[model samples]
Target: MHRPAVHRRDPRLEIITEAVERLIPRATPAHLTVTVTETLPGTANPDGTPHKHTWTGKPEGLAVKVFTALFGRPRTEEQRSPLAQAEDAKRARDLVGELDALLAGGVALETAPWYPCRPGDLVHVHHRAVGDVPLTPAFGETYIVGDAGDGLMSMQLLAHTLPDTVEHAADMVGCFAAEAADCPVYEVWFEAGAHLLTVVRDGRPVHVGGAR
Candidate 1:
């Protein structure tokens, strides 16, 4: 059985969340965009507010000033308008569709945060939480696509297979292991695409349905 998850707050991320919570005027769009700085870039008043808080030489908006007080000053930051970000995501989804065949060929894990699910190999997974309460499906399943040995596996996601994502999704919170199998070797669907997800049973590959 999977153990319940534990969560802790990150002080740095909290700086932004708290500023938004305390200072954001109610009715602010859920998608409001603002540029902020960790650096106040000016003298501080006795109470600590910067004497000359500004952005790129111009005075900062209220949101920027609030964040500036929390973070020293950012070296670089960018906030695209929500609509623009949405458009980018839409285009990206289309692009992923176009490259389905290529993506199906293989997968790799990001170096620093590689998640391991080898029986008895323990690892910590970062995921969303509400005041120490982890979100359900906190660790979404990984549907492993193939083996890369030395504990690295090319995985995907679904309940019974490897796990839930073809790749790491922004909100994936859990890892999955099969109950029992004889080389699953099956087709699996990912966001707007499909690919083969194969599993080895007792050191052997199970090829099926035109898949190797």
Candidate 2:
């Protein structure tokens, strides 16, 4: 029997990278060095795009120990339960497996920064938390609103003390209407439980309303 081809690139790595990036600033100690390693002879990505893998710097079967060493053990007993611990261990093992597979495929691993958003660039928001209104952006004198699941009309005004600030529906109609208004503003919207905001000309997001 012939064996099917194995996928070289894993999409879960992206999620891990994003999560690690977000948590590193807060969770990791400043003194510790974080590195990503990849196996040699990289392979092609599923989407036909170039891809890289992050190395955990730990040998196979030791990922859980490495993860615990870096992040520390769970604080509460509830989180340290057998099932919870198993989940964490599984995550570590999966990460290691993915990295090993990528390296075997000749995928080059390199260090990279996690950039959630950049100015003047279109970004896709992926919100993990649920709320009525997740993201809001302000331009010049107007506001761009994004509603996650709640109705547009029920959206709340973000805390801002600027003049001529108005809330536009999260939909295209509202976004375009705001853009058409005399007041200049960046377009903002939410999708897939995340907030998507258009960056302004300046190298900064117009404004992220509500506590990030």
Candidate 3:
């Protein structure tokens, strides 16, 4: 069973989330279902370490149709607006190129302040890409696509969360890892046109779906 989530606050988290919501136009009640939740600390991987505080949630619109069909829920998928589609694609490519540049630049964990919700700290940002879907189904769901590092993953590696900015996102760069920089695989998704979602670690400034 999934354990109950925790609650905490970070200024950066709020900023990023607001940015995503404002920046991405498709994440409306008419288009998606977005849920932001905080995760409690727990056991680490086999390396015997403590877990980190985490946050995760789905975007507002992508799965409305499929999810509703699968579970008899309401139909909330927006009309598949052309503007939304175009915007999603452009953002996905932009994010991919941006992350690639960060790696190429040799940037590291020193970019942002360490997340306050966990034991360890920011390490690096690992990135993955998924193609031709409603959104990048990285980590098993849709999200604004981006890479993450181990400092963010120590709690629950590969967990997904929405975006919130607390004045720390612009500075975040490169993938982080506590054990192996490329150990556990991460997934990211991009819709055909106007949306890109990435599920990165909490307190690390990596948020899924588009942040404004």
Would you estimate the TM-scores of all the predictions? 0.21, 0.19, 0.20
**Model-by-model lDDT, in order?**
0.31, 0.30, 0.31
TM-score for predicted model 1 compared with the true structure: 0.21
Q: Put down candidate 1 lDDT per residue, 160-187, tens digits, no spaces.
A: 3223442444334323333333222111
Quote the lDDT for 186 in model 2: 19
When 2 and 3 are scored with lDDT, the better candidate is 3
Residue-level lDDT of model 2, residues 72-160, one tens digit each, is: 53222221112233345567787665455333222211221222222223232222323445344322222332333322211222323
Q: Pick the candidate with the highest TM-score.
A: 1
**Candidate 2, residue 119: how far the Cα is off, in Å:** 28
What is the lDDT for 178 in model 3? 29
Instruction: Answer with 1 or 2, whichever has the higher lDDT.
Output: 1
Against the hidden true structure, what lDDT does model 1 obtain? 0.31
Which residue runs of candidate 2 sit more than 4 Å off their true CA positions? 1-14, 22-25, 28-33, 36-155, 160-212
Of the two candidates 1 and 2, the one with more favorable TM-score, higher being better, is 1
Q: What would you estimate as the lDDT of candidate 3?
A: 0.31
Q: Find the 10 residues in a row with the least total lDDT in model 3.
A: 1-10
With candidate 1 superimposed using the best TM-score fit, by how many Å does residue 190's alpha carbon deviate from the native? 5.7
What would the per-residue lDDT of candidate 3 be over residues 99-179, giving only the tens digit for each residue? Answer: 543342222112222212233322222233346651332322222222345443332234333223323322322232223
